[model samples]
Target: MAHAQDASLVARDDIPKTFDDVIPGGQDFTRKEVMIPMRDGTKLFTVIIIPKGAKDAPMILTRTPYNAGERAGNPKAMTIGDAVPLADAAFVEAGYIRVYQDVRGKYGSEGKYIMMYPPRGPLNPTKTDETTDGWDTIDWLVKHIPESNGRVGMIGSSYEGETVAMALLDPHPALKAAVPESPMIDTYMGDDWFHYGAFRQMMLGYVHMQTVQKGAGAVTPTDTYDKYEEYLRAGSVGDYIRSRGLEKLPFVARMMAHPAYDSFWQGQDLARLMAAKPSNVPTLWEQGLFDQEDMWGANHAWLALKAAGHAANNWLVMGPWSHSQVNGKGYNVGPFKWEGDTARFYNRQMVLPFFEQYLRDGQPAKLARVNIYNTGDDRWDAFDDWPTSCAKGCGTALTPLYLSKGASLAFDKPADAQAADTYVSDPAKPVPFLPRPVLDPFFGYGTDFAGYIPWSSWLLHDQRFVDGRSDVLTYETPVLTSAVRVQGTPKVDLRAMTTGTDGDFVVKLIDVFPPSVPSDPAMGGYQMAIAMDILRGRYRESFEHPTAIPANTPQAYAFELPNVNHVFKPGHRIMVQVQSTLFPLYDRNPQTFVPNIFNAKPGDYQPATITVLRSDSQPSAVWLPVVGKSTTP
Candidate 1:
């Protein structure tokens, strides 16, 4: 059997990793490719799609790490509609020139690829950064593409959206408008990589999908069907990644090196960076109320710019969609419906008009400073500003929905002397984020709901699945007699203690539908979470510092959940779910304090008794942004 040199004997690691380009059909537009050179001599591959008879047209560009070819569709296909992403269809029809570029070191671009590509400074030794690249590309487009009207705007979702936000930091004169839809802003604080300091290990698959190769290489599917079983079997996310050799990726290794929210992560925070260098670029920050990946990006960026005095030109639009769902058909999320093709309506009414005003030098339309979609009643709400409870309040109050005795949620402060709920957080039986048979996030959860909704609306999943779990502690109000509205970020004032030295806390604000519905009778007693978040125990005091908690110590864990524009209709109940682990969604905290969780030993994984204190001295409650104190008992 000495056949080591045999051609047929292929090593498992030597197997080819092929990536397929999944793009829409070909289109009738004039498509062309160019290698636009940057100041550093790196040539970024760009795809330009000019509409039929285009002349003096404003350009709408999307700079993406994902292959531009994949985003621009096949060149050999048929109609104009088939040329670009569905989100660009409206702009294309409106006679806008569509352009897509592969960021440096991705696809046909030439340069070293760094995830997020930190801005040019001490962190980035070389001169080139995302901002420089954006400026260079825009300069090239205005000079070379004679068909362009010398006016350009940036628009994209997800990673592409992040690029747009990056460009705004050092915007070119031609860069008139920007629309960052569901952009990933910060990794460790609030965005994809981690929530507070709890590592979102579930997103490890995304590392392979993005960073394995130059093009978007397909992530190898797990041997096991359920990710829960796979992740659980590996013990730790670090173990799983190390076992697969994924830790070798630069970004992965860098992420592992800095578990704390140190300079490595903070240096790239878009919101913070934008605050330092506030731009006058007219920005329309689009956020999906239930965006699974990037609920924090656009919101924080909007707030930072406003607070930094770059307020007037900055606008916000939060819709009742999930992660970039506004780019696709958005009639509904989960079992809820929004009457019409809401995505189409948004593109036509808001996007097209907004771009027309800034890019095309057209009449400025009347757009609200902060336009949001109300979930409970399914209507859009326009406001002059946000958080309605800020400085000059807008009838919004920080109403504390206190966790009370006997598993009740109350508007009044808890008067109980020693009312507390205790549960054993066994790592061996960590609760699942969604019901078991949790699938891979790499494959994606499209907007589809047959028997179950395994898509972007995962947050909107019914809380009833984990309602009875011993580890999960749920508190709810009695059936509401009147509608209650929550219109901003809900702060969690968690008074908790753990038997172990380390722990995690997940909080959810849910709106429980009535037990029975008249018109949609099948849709009864659904517990949809309006806002949810998690915080790692060590980062309780400072996100930048990690400290060990004294065993059996009562500590306060405070954090803000993402923005919400939800209402609790009459007959419905308000709910608050408290738990230690989100399971595979976030990595196990291991309970025992260790120097590094990545290198935690098996013995570190201990079962801890978690207590939610509801006493008058240590009252646990979620501060809701109640619109009017209108809820009736």
Candidate 2:
């Protein structure tokens, strides 16, 4: 069936125009493609863009797994731009020598490519990895490039951002500044591949994009537009990969073999690497407030570096954008639009100044250590350091919002001695994580990349589609008399029981807008999911050694959702949605425990009845970090 588009919801009138008008013509810069040799004798493809008549300028470098030299010989490629249109135009005009390189074993680069590749230890001086490759490339640029200042800086987003981090591990003497935005640090603990212990099923598409298609130059093998159906037919994750006949893809095979947080994943953890030997490089950790994939990585990396007693020169900036939108002209996500050219504002106010201070020593830095954009209030807040830093004391205490009868949420604790809510969860009929008829059918709903599934900006999509469903247990506060602001991490504490030995619990924090807002037809009574997460009941106690739940007995399952900074306006209401399954986005929990969820058989799937307890002693509530007193109307 063809996907139907709702004209009201699918309209793109709010999309901001490109800022490419500011980009200077390519005639101003000279371009050259070079093959830089690494310590292992393997050559990596790089593109250098130099401004004509410019001398002794600070050099800026970016290394990416994606093709950095896609249009190598074309004059149009001379302008050092990014995936975002005209975002790097200012840097080009500033006359910095720009360099872009393809990381080993992708596109034009030569060498084996490993996904989220770990660094070689200090003892392995002869061995080569991402760190050594970066050091070698930097060494070459400072010596060979003409009109070059000795100082250098690095910046990139997503996978490219991770490369910037890798470069910092063993920084070159000339490397002065580095910014890794929305980097992927750990696949097992958090980020990209998995969330807690639950394997992100969308990663299957990513594996296909990076391995099957890129490796063999093959087209996407599937013909169907609806990937959700395709995934369902495969029964289990292992069955899905094996059905593709992709034994040659080592990463995919390794993921299936190691279903838990084992040694295999521990070796790839970048957090450990940073803690062991933190980089002394002055760094800026930037990310979108709503970045789907690597939202937790940059934050965790900064905290780990500080805990390890690394010299404190780190700064952070989080804006109201998605992964790619961080560098784009617009900062709109779904129906929610932020005022002004937020991306350009960031470049002009924060980014450019940062590089100028560190790379060129042009000016004293005035930016704060932690800068975050509050989504609800549409304002930026500055702090000396992260909220978690004990010295800063910027974080606030978590206030519990309890679930009550009559579909209501309140701050007052449960008065009932024994009250509970129950729902039947069927694997055959799972709740859709996103609304039907996604904008792009082939790419799937709430997915970023066409080749692989990354976190999209679907969290901002209206949750009205599932609000009326019987399977979804929703609770909302009465129309708010004042604006309530929430900052930092939100936790869901559940006291519950299940008929089956294994299941899954999904919780969503929503912002319910009043009917007065006319931005879109669906804006009236729009229920936007601000934060959401899922937990596998089997892994409730431990991710490494998951134990089956005691059937028909009450148990506690608590976990923290990703951090959020938002405000609920005076007329809006706060909402909490609890459900068992989030189909397609996450694999279905069989309700029958299997040693390895990836290897479960068709017969392992079963239905279960879930009960959420609400007694005074065992109350289930969502904990929010309240920043200050509510602003009353």
> Which candidate ranks first by lDDT, i.e. highest?
1
Error of 2 at 521 (Å): 5.1
Model 2 TM-score (2 dp)? 0.89
For model 2, the stretches where C-alpha displacement exceeds 4 angstroms are: 1-26, 71-74, 77-85, 121-126, 213-219, 388-395, 437-455, 518-521, 631-633
In lDDT terms, how accurate is model 1?
0.87
Top TM-score hit: 1
Per-residue alpha-carbon lDDT of candidate 2 for residues 125-148, written as tens digits (9 for 90 to 100): 348878888899999999989788
Per-residue lDDT over 59-118 for candidate 1, one digit per residue giving the tens place of the 0 to 100 score? 999999988988887576565666677778889888898999999889999998888888
